[model samples]
Target: MSATVSPIREPLIEGGKSYHDITVDLVRSTEKAPTRLWWIAFLISVHVLLFGVFCILWTIWHGIGTWDLNRTIGWGWDITNFVWWIGIGHAGTLISAILLLFRQKWRTGVNRAAEAMTIFAVMCAGLFPVIHMGRVWMAFFIFPYPNTRGSLWPNFNSPLLWDVFAISTYLTVSLLFWYSGLVPDFATIRDRATGLRKRIYNFLSFGWTGSAKHWQRFEALSLVLAGLATPLVLSVHTIVSFDFATSVIPGWHTTIFPPYFVAGAVFSGFAMVLTLMLITRKVLKLEQYITIGHIESMNKIILVTGTIVGVAYLTELFISWYSGYIYEQFAFFNRALGPYYWSYFGMMFCNVVSPQLFWSRKIRRSLWWTFLMSIFINIGMWFERFVIIATTLARDYLPSSWSYYVPTWVEIGIFIGTLGLFFTLYLLFTRVAPVVAVAEVKAILKSAGDQYLAPNTEHHEEIMKQYKDAEDKGKVYGSDHAHSESH
Candidate 1:
């Protein structure tokens, strides 16, 4: 396709980075010593992770009795954190798979980090269900593998059991999708690296060469994995919603949970992506690649999904009242006016009220504002889960069993620990791989890059087009330029 005139678009890539400069700029952080800021962030995250690990061990030794899970509230912080992390992880595959399939060039700026976030977030999320099991060692029972005792089989009918398959499959496919995109980038580092680092990256990259055949297979495999991952994005969260929606509890059993949860997942997921991205772009000196345009684009998603979530929230309430189900009515009423009213309001303010700021383009484009709001949205998402679980579970069918639920210090620690663990992994990831997709940024640089950086001259555009044309024909371009550049 040829570039045509349009209303002038902001350059997705700033600073006129050539294909070579993209490699250098993206890989520079990995090759150098950790900055003071990097160490400070890493250490803080590590300490938080350690605190979380201690809490996990304490929970394991003492059992969930350490948690404040009462008779009425069997699922509290653990389940809430589980859902929150899972929702947070959704942006990765959404960026990598869904955006890739749609051919959105903007995804190049953030998809690599988002995909990594999905993997790490899922790791943090998977912890909750296992630990919440009370007996941590028997966590494997959720797996559908054949048991030694023939009669004692995993419950196929259980939604919790469905989570095992759905999440595992999602993780596996996401891992593949994430790693596949990293191969050429890894190879880039390998070529640029020294003895030991070169050897390591060479192994990681599986000896990738800038051959026509290699790029051909890489693109093909990416599509296949994206095709596999796209459905998992929708299905994994829908199955997660079943954990609540399939329940008999008044507010819990509803047809709305599937779409509600999916929208909420994408909402929170995009918010999280923005939060991490804002920080990442700053710390890594990647402003040229992860530009303000990327920020505005993602915020648009947050606006759309946040609006969907707001409607879902209203729908849940309307359905309860309009259905004339006394139990459902009381469930939502308790959430608003009952003991947990504080959390309910927080949820509404953060998820619904706050994201509405993005209706103003200036607000969406502002870094400080977007970062601040991202934090707000995530906190609100946690509140939303809490309201859903606590309000519904705390007051049940039997009045005598009704009680207020509060998380123990242990629950809060584990949740914070997961936060720490997530950041710790992400901080470490910056050292090991290019946070931005190096190959992909190059792929779209001509078309989507800044106005000045675009091939305004015939010579430059032709140089860029040779690579694009070969890529389209599934053959590598010539060695007239750098091998990695053409690759």
Candidate 2:
């Protein structure tokens, strides 16, 4: 009888890619010189970064007056962008830590790039609060660290200080976890390179020897880091929500903010991951590794989180009305029907209505449609933060004191500058390393690869070469360890 195949199951790695094929294909982009397309993208990003730097310097020279902050609406695009960036960073840790714990094989395809996105996005997020302080030089006043100016201490009670602690800790853990995974992969590149390149990669890989002992330590360390990072995925965003939830402002002081913010973060995080990967898969000829199956898995998450965010929106409205507090009711009412009604509606359409389209399998799996939807979701998430900040502050208690918050060209440029900085960092990351996790991807190849799952005549012959001796002698092939040897 012939071996039967399960129709319900699909290959995680497509194109019947082999173990050898994985190394050559994944490492090819990094080995080759930067393409003309990469150059074009890099140049555009650098130009944007330069313009943003000029704007930041202009703000510093001109003072906070260069921004559009006023008596009524003191917060503007700065804080909005800060929260937005932090939300974008959440998916990296979640995918790397939570999925690892649960043993989800699909996460292997995208986790490396997602982790890098987290670091870059957090770096972008950190830039805003420092600049928002106006007296950028005295930003140290917000920190609890002792300085030459005596034992000056920041208020322990301040939610903003809590933000400084939570975010910094989150970044530290994420960096360590990300780099640990890169070590083995770096050794792979080191083995393949010559002269200066080999030396550099050797240093980066920390002299990895592919020994059983080395693999054991790597696996143990990954488990420990995964355990540490799992809590951070929940804690970081929950702490961020505290920035608004702890506030006295009508729209800001709600119990739902914690869960609401967390869900919205995951929602936006997956969308961003999708956005970057869609472009990357096409650009680097990685459609086989980052396949349609991977896209569908992530899209399913976007759908779930998007629905949670929509419910949170409704809950906010219902609570404001149910509380029978006029100011509270008006706070949300103004968001829906007041001066910033456009953003409120746009947020709803993008975060709620757009994601509903993914209920259909074909639509969620369509790369072009998914790309377009991911962009829309990111924009909507940005609008959600804007609504929470600008709309709530713009139409506060006294009608006469109410003023509109507008971002000056300086503020706008700095925001764009952060975007440029984020992309610039990511592009450099793609150039230097395998954006996909080569080691982890190879680990799952036999279990999840299409050719391995259902071997044809060609696959059967290759399998015989790889396993004939082991099968006869009942011996293992190198202790179930990945054969990391270079041909």
Candidate 3:
């Protein structure tokens, strides 16, 4: 006797959508005129971004002295916001490149938006270091080039300079990977377009004809880029951590900073992704494409990364105590019990304690709760940066030199401006580009759609045997009727 096997479970794409339906749904947002809601959000983002630009201009005109930087705290909100934006960018690469390499198909629903977020977040991150240079005009000095001013070159030993190379390389590679994925989708749009739109998409598509060779190259390139990006995602943050770890500062210098920073980055990055995707799904009506399953999967990641970050926090405290170093121990204690202790506790609550709610299946599946938690995670991560940078610097080794650092209005404006800039770009991207990867989503149609079937060999054989037995019974009945009629 044979037991029956169950078929594969639920579909990734719900509502029984076809390949054409997927294309239509994704491209519809791009083709339609901007909604009132879109315009409202865009204007708000622009307003904030412009304000940030004004603040940046003010800083450049008056010099870096316009802000709160002083002898005791050379890096304050500028570096804090820089690290925050950089960490937020990491989730995009992790979702798009790392998950792709791991063969995680669920990534297809979120990768396009996540990749865009990464690019925009990096753009925001790059601005801080550049503007932090008082003479923004002389920012090119950070790059190594033969110049008339002797043989002056950027110091290769400095992790700051390493950031120059690492960030630039990461940005370039990420752009290529993102655009490569877009080409096929661009071609889809091009084929459906006419006149000027047609011409624009045609150029964007690079004459893609959907040929077997084009797809072959596309897949090969995606795999290659994914491989390159997997190590890159790790290396970029690791190098960023190096900027602090290599320093002589007590709290900053630690062997655990690399993994600690990487985990924190992933945590913050996923939070931002959830925040954006939740809104996108609701506004753009993409529930069928980005289902509850996708949201739940991301929540699990947030839970994992958040826990890892919480452990790192505890470990740092433990290591400081165990080392019995005066400065190190004082720094950790200062972070918790000092003047900025509120920020530390806030970070702990948001990053460490909040994500634990995901352990409940109900909360993970609830849209509103997920969104609220994502916001909390973002806040916690920001406070984490504040605790790391400001608190550590506010109380230095010497009591005489210790001073509190507060962000001036200029610094505040610029940080707020970067937020505006990020949203502005993202809002525009949603309007013009496919928020969902059309081709990638299409590729998964067979496995994710309603028409999917189980290919269990045992079940197939059992069904075949039942059909043969029925046929034999019918033949026997027919033979009996013929004999009875003849008699």
Clashing pairs in 2: none
Clashing pairs in 1: 11-450
Please give the lDDT score at residue 356 for candidate 1: 97
TM-score for each predicted model, relative to the true structure: 0.92, 0.91, 0.92
What does the lDDT come to for candidate 3? Answer: 0.91
Off by over 4 Å in 2: 1-7, 148-150, 455-487
Residue-level lDDT tens digits of model 2 in 1-487 = 2334343456788887877899988888889999999999999999999998999899889898889799888889999999999999999988999899998888999999999999999999999989988889988788777777778688899888989988999889999999999998999999999999999999999998889988999899998899998888788889889999999999999999999999999999999999999999999999999999999999999999999999999999999999999999999999999999999999999999999999999998899999999999999999999999999999988999988877888999999999999999999999998999999999888777877665544565677667876755757766444444532
Displacement of residue 148 (Cα, Å) in model 1 is 2.2
Q: lDDT of each prediction vs. the true structure?
A: 0.91, 0.91, 0.91
Model 3 per-residue lDDT tens digits across residues 54-101: 999999999999887889888889988999999999999999999998
Q: What tens digits encode model 1's per-residue C-alpha lDDT throughout 1-487?
A: 4365233456789887778999999999899999998999999999999999999999999988989788898899999999999999998889999998998888999999999999999999999999999888888777766678774888789998999999999888898888888998999999998899999999999888879988898899998888888888999999999998998999999999999999999999999999999988998889999999999999999999999999999999999999998999999999999999999999999999999999999999999999999999999999999999887899998999999888889999999999999999999999999999999999887777665434454455686788788866767645444666766
Cα lDDT, model 2, residue 56: 89
Candidate 1 Cα outliers beyond 4 Å, as residue runs: 1-7, 451-487
